[model samples]
Target: MLDRRRVLQTLAGLFLSSFGLGGYAYAWEPAHQGVTRYRLKPARWPEGRRLRLAVITDLHVGGPHMPVARVRQIVEQTNALKPDLTLLVGDFVASRTRRSSDPAPAEWAAELARLQAPAGRFAVLGNHDWWQDERAQKELRGPTQSTVALEAVGIPVLENRAVRLQTGAGPLWIAGLGDQEAFVLRRRPRGLPYGLDDLPATLAMIRDDAPVILMAHEPDIFARVPSRVALTLSGHTHGGQVRLFGWSPIVPSRYGNRYAYGHVRENGRDLVVSAGLGTSKLPIRLGAPPEIVLIELG
Candidate 1:
């Protein structure tokens, strides 16, 4: 048998070794790039009403970073959640600086179309789509091509339009706005042809009492959204792309990190902004992991 001093020293060394190995394993392992789920508890949610919404955005497909495998993984994970509504918040392709000869990035839309929900799947345009190649991107809506890829599979694209949902409780309106950042950056006369200014008018068109859920690409407009709208789902900030010390290093938006990522409350409107599955500008992430936000509406 070993002496007490010898045994104590041996145990100390083993403890240190194990701790070091564990730390290194955690640090070296690829950042957990998977979808994360969240439950949103609203103050006035109607009892027995459950609306599970999965929001995906900023998937800059066709790059060394995101690749096809990662995109598929995101889709699989999303479907696993079994959300009632699957909202594709845009940035499907990164075409701004890519060339025509480059492998078409729109193919991912077909992959995304596989995502199914009881109610339906819907999508809207993001700023990157317009900046990259509006014409080629628009091809996604074409029949022969992948334009209607999402819709072809079953996910309908909602561009500055609204859809009426038949919920267990009653009826709710789901509307999607076109790319707001594109118009904002372009200094266009009108941000969106039908925007916050015409929200009341649009609501008048949709006959529903369960409240309206707006799908805008970015959360910057959350402040301007009417409180009566209830909730807004968006992506595009990529949760600041890279996070540091639990905060995004740089959130590329006019609102900065305030509305950078995750769930944020602004002007009494609940907004869930996904960090996104793919990377943009860079292929690495620190504190910010790729995510699938499970928004629960009661």
Candidate 2:
């Protein structure tokens, strides 16, 4: 009889622990925001020159987890960092259909417009941005609503393009690749690329030999990223949205946790994948908290 009582107690304890963990994951971690910082001196970085970049990505705004007020708070927090460059790495709109509000594009863009950076603020669209655009999906072409909204607020959406920024270090080139999963092509056209991304053409636009920072929404592209790019930034997997002890069980990337989150260096190339600012699918997070990534480079 005593042994039976001990087994019941053990089962009760396990049940309570799981309930508590679930509550924290659902109610607490998803709402709270934090900052993650990385300082790296890439091999190609100009000597004695430093650059601070604030990266905000996977906002998935308009959802219960990320309202306009949260976006405003994010902008305020990013501005406080006083970064040299601010990068909006994409997924501004919410993908979840349930328990989500549809905040107009302008509403969120207005809040993001308040973000300030010394060099400039730049942007790239994510898969969700294109997926949400009905017209773009049907036409298999873009000028997605996400792009129009950002551009309307004076933030340039860099789609497979590169621009030179005059930073304290020197001329730094920022190249943004279009969303690789931009459109759901109905039928593959002969000789036509699957998605909107054009990495080769984008790289061709670079006229000078300045160190380059590439922004691709999905980190899978990092596998093909050449050594020429000093660093690459991405936000998509959301660090599996429930990471624990530096391992995520369900990473969305094709490469699994290899490019899941944080700084990853491979064969002389570097990539930093932000855990991102808002939840996706089901608004729940565990060990991986929402974050604004700050990268210091030299």
Candidate 3:
């Protein structure tokens, strides 16, 4: 008995409601924090010593999407967890498109320096960091001044290198790898020393007796890693950024949804892919809200 006009109006109303909800989710839902906790059991881990690691990555810290205040909050949250180590995988500065970021990299690093990790705070560059300033980066210099700024704040960026830290149990080796596709965006993707990963050199530094924790921005590296190395941590997918019904339509990586988010077991190697705390490209975050990952190693 309903008229055609009435039915059409009803459909329009439903469509508008759906659009508004999506808009709200994109704008505000991402602000909701999701803390993912996990236990990492690596080979050669001492019986009594416990290591807690907090992984924070893909922090496109420019623009209103991830302002300085938010950065401070994230740092504070990490500190509150009292992790023994904090690994900051890259993308420190926002691209030119995001004009609202204040306090810049130095200020951001300063806040990060406040991070207290008895083991240490280490970092590596993400693709976004390398591509933030295309002109300067295209010249093959480095990740620009962000590295210097990070070092100034006492957090060092590690690239295909391993460092030994004396933990309560014993000595633990932590290695940081470069972004696999960092340079491809500037030029043609090529062989080793290609700006992203340097597995051979990085693994060479690991001693036979020491257990290692690896840091990589993209989770694709997880597949190639060896089981001798206990756990690999990464955060590039942003948990698909906006997932629906527990699945996101968009995930930026060569591996598709395989390494999208959370903990994954690949080739018997444990990988924790963080759902990072900041958004990229868009100001929206839905199913995958921002998070500060706390990984406990026993």
Candidate 4:
């Protein structure tokens, strides 16, 4: 016969193990559908010209769990919004360490290529992409291959660079910087090409007359951005991964709570950080569901 304490301990271990498994499964399922709308009020945007922009990020594509079908569905839904411009804010593929080693990013890229917009469709690299060295090679979700794949289907990937888009009235200056996290790694800095030269100086290169919209994968870089930028778009937080009843489980940031999740304003500039469409390491999201944000530039 087993002792009382041993029996209790065995039961407790089973209960805890089951709870962990259940929680993981619950968070892994892709929940929430339909579009989220936001009317942005920018002080510098020209009057009477409203730009429809759709932002999607954290699609850690290339897993049996992620499946290209999901990406196709996301693209179809996004195109239905009829955005003037679509921005892919990075993390296109899951890091090698994260995936189960079956599906690859090429499959996902083909699905992502299906996305389209009238004015343009653009993208930026995520930390995961850098870790996978997709920038150096032309295959499997590398920055070069990922960019090439998108451009093939008409979406351009901006890496620490800027592009000028012409609206009905005039042109708007758009810029994108690579993942800032890659820059901090001293040992393998060259291993990842996710460094920004000088954010302040880069914005200076764009025309001052046009409204500047910038994309940096990590929102933490917002502090370094120059004042001329009208708005900054970012991801990587996944909106705190797991949001409790009234709090986020763990907000992984250097500043801690300064820019944890969602839309925030700093130094009179606007920032829209998506809750994201896909999961990272654990493949789960709680109170915070996957999101697709539609920003009406006003």
lDDT of 2 by residue, 1-298 (tens): 1232343344335434798876787788889999999999887888898999999999998776888999999999999999999999999998753232488899999999999988999999998898788788777888888899999999999999999989887899999999987764346567666568888998898898899999999999999888889999999989877676998767777778899999999988899999998887676777789999999997
Give the per-residue lDDT of model 3 (tens digit) for 1-298. 3332343344435434788765666567666565689986665566777888888987778755677888888888889899888899877776344243255668788888899988889998887777765554657657456787899878889988899998765788889997787665555535435565889899999876778888998888887898778888888788877666866565776666788888887666788888887776665666788888998888
What is the TM-score (0 to 1) of candidate 2? 0.91
Off by over 4 Å in 3: 1-20, 95-102, 188-194
For model 4, residues 25-65, the per-residue Cα lDDT tens digits are: 34343444456788987767778878888999988776334
Worst 10 residues of 1 by lDDT: 138-147
Tens-place lDDT per residue, model 1, 180-279, is: 6553333334333322223444555566456788888878878777766778888888776556676764676677788888888765668888887666
| TM-scores vs. true structure, each candidate | 0.77, 0.91, 0.87, 0.82
| Candidates ranked by TM-score | 2, 3, 4, 1
lDDT of 2: 0.86
Q: Which stretch of 10 consecutive residues in model 2 shows the poorest summed lDDT?
A: 1-10
Runs of candidate 1 exceeding 4 Å displacement: 1-32, 100-106, 134-148, 183-204
lDDT accuracy of residue 194 in candidate 3: 52
| lDDT agreement with native, every candidate | 0.66, 0.86, 0.76, 0.70
Stronger candidate by TM-score (1 vs 3): 3
Error of 2 at 146 (Å): 0.7
Please tell me which model should have the higher TM-score, number 3 or number 4.
3
